[model samples]
Target: MSDATSRKVKRFSESDRNSEFDAATQKALEEIDVCQNEIDSINEKSSEEILKIEQKYNRLRKPFYEKRNNLISNIPNFWITAIMNHPDLSALLDETEEDCLHHLTKLEVEEFDDIKSGYWIKFYFEENPYFENSVITKEYHLDSATPTSESTQIIWKEGCSLAQNVEANKPGKKRRHEPAKTFFSWFNDNVDPYTDDIAEIIKDDLWLNPLQYYLVPDVEGDGENGVDAEEVSSSEDDEEREGGEEESRNQRK
Candidate 1:
């Protein structure tokens, strides 16, 4: 046999062939795979458990918000405060819409453990004669940052909360498309419930920001240009970081 071939062949007694180190290394690799699988299983179980708890908590939450229905709003301009607290989402709000969003009473989000149903937004509004309903609920089938309108659908529902007596005066008949020009007009249009699915309804971004998009002004939104401002701000931040890195490198010299 060639020298290399002879070297490659090892007997069981050889130190390198059956060494404890080699056995330990093999065992460690196997253990890593086992650990990874264990972690995955645990995470899956944990998520299910968390979702269960969320469902239970949501049950308690619903009644609490429902109690406020038809009652005077105690939280003054809650939507405005919520939006301003979040930088990125606030950037999406225009001056006009921000003022109009003050009337937003309650914004509830529904989460299904099953990823198929996706997430739902249930908006509770104060009585306004301008639109057909007070609550405009929509469910969007979005994954990550991409809106999967085909895989699922944006199931939209309008809730009439005019306390029966006031329902007769609902003004959707005359100026059919008038108030839509004002703030919250966007909600009146069921054709495209979102401002822009690709830009505004960034599913993951809202989740990350804890529903900052819900701070969306109660009026028709005017921040179609806000996304550009956000992009500029982000690019500026990146440049600042790069400049800091260059300064550090120069200091090292």
Candidate 2:
């Protein structure tokens, strides 16, 4: 009778233990389901937020598109006519087109060849007179031996700006002075919209000034170049010292 009683007690204890384990397992499974549902809900919300932001950006881009088209249409036809007429300018424009195509295809050149055209156009518009004016004037005296003879005077006159303004405001202005826009227009027209992945390829090719490149690093560390080599060595030394102190304390304890 005593042996049977002991056996029965052991069986009951085992049964209780099994029941507790099952309850714990069931709770854990429920928690996992709840966590999965929450994750799904968060992901759905994030996706919706992202879609809304994209839609907002798309709406904002509409104005820029309209402005770009208007600018293109407003471009004077005379420049195109001039480019067609002038052999040198025409050749330069053709070379620029070829270079641009090469860049779009291979992403090799950093700046478009039309950049030179733009510079020329800008110079033309500015009417810089450096090319035509020969006025000689001295302002400073170089030597003390003959004050009058050594007096240096610089002859400066506005040449290009005057010419550029005159040309730009002519009664029937035919040329486009804005080089950047001209280049952009040429790019849009010549490149295959579907196949030219140049935009994606060139997205990261933006010209960053030295300061801009390391702005964050400058803020966090010593300057744009980052903490000097000496500073880095010093920091390492400090860390080593702290580690040694920690080990020493542990040993003492």
Per-model TM-score versus the true fold? 0.40, 0.24
RMSD of each: 18.0, 29.7
- Give per-residue lDDT, candidate 2, residue 77: 40
Worst 10 residues of 1 by lDDT: 160-169
For model 2, residues 1-253, the per-residue Cα lDDT tens digits are 2354445445545565556557667556545555666676789899878767756765666476445534534443423333333323333344443332222211111222222111000101112233232221112121344321111122225432212232342324453433312333323222122232222222222111111221223233463366676787888899999999999999999
What lDDT does model 2 reach? 0.36
RMSD value for candidate 1:
18.0
Model 1, stretches more than 4 Å misplaced?
1-21, 68-90, 98-106, 113-117, 124-134, 142-253
Looking at model 2, which ten-residue stretch has the lowest summed lDDT?
Answer: 116-125
Relative to the true structure, how large is the alpha-carbon lDDT of every model?
Answer: 0.49, 0.36
Tens digits of lDDT, candidate 1, 1-253: 3343333332322554556667767556545655666676789899988877877776776665555432424656655566555545465455655654565676655555554346666666565433435666656565545443221122223452212212222334332322233223333333322333422433445433433443555443333565565666788899999999999999999
TM-score of 1: 0.40
